[model samples]
Target: MVRITNTIDIDASTQQVYAALRALDAYPTWLRHSTVYRGTKMRTPQSGKSLSYEDSTMVGRMRGEVVEDVPDHALQFHQRKPSGSLDALIRYEVSAAGTGTHLTRVGELTTHGMLHIVQPILLRMAAAESERTMKSLKAHVEGHPI
Candidate 1:
């Protein structure tokens, strides 16, 4: 198991940040390695909803379920590979920071089979990608290009 956590302060209100997080369709624009959903479109973040999508950095198409959803507060997703070789949980928490919003992202990944041999490298990559994504999210919310 590996865990990666990142936090970023967005120069926007909590509502604005939350709205942006819920906009799954725009993920490919700022999120590194993200791709469009293939099965069903995610209109909004709601508990029990499932999304099937593919990411460039992932092994294959992944299916994720919304485990928890609190508007303007927190959102959590649990994803797993189709073959059950990999599983991950991603969580986003938002809070008021001065006049802006403080967003924290936490990711945990577990691997099986041959993936265990390179777990350390995968964890490092996840951390780096997460940092990049944070910068992009901040830039996007602040109306600038990353």
Candidate 2:
């Protein structure tokens, strides 16, 4: 298993940050190299219902499910191929910091079958991607040029 975490400061309110994170359509707007993110299923915000999205990236594409969402606080999910072989558990968190928000994203990837052969490389790539996305998200959500 490989795990990584990234954090960025957003000059926005917690609510605003949460809203951006909750909107599936806005993911690709901030996340670089993310070409697709369509919410096929979603639960009400109050119920903190699970949501599923299909994402396409330069490397490949996969389906991801939101497993946890705490308003103004955090969002967590598990991502995998449609075959359900490799898995990526991800979490996003927000905190009120002074007058802004501190956003954090954490992810763990586990491989099955022969995918383990490239686990190290994949982990490194994921870490780099996570950092890049967080920085872009911070700029985009904070109303800065991205």
Clash totals for all candidate models: 0, 0
Q: What is the C-alpha lDDT of each candidate?
A: 0.77, 0.76
**lDDT per residue, candidate 1, 1-146, as tens digits?**
78899999999999989888777667777665543222323434456545433443456566676677799999887877778887889899999999999999999999998878878877877787778878888998899986
Badly placed stretches (over 4 Å) of model 2 are 34-49
Q: What residue pairs clash in candidate 1, if any at all? A: none
Poorest lDDT segment (10 consecutive residues) of candidate 2: 34-43
TM-score of 1: 0.84
Report clash pairs, candidate 2. Answer: none
Candidate 1: worst-modelled 10 consecutive residues by lDDT: 34-43
Q: Pick the candidate with the highest lDDT.
A: 1
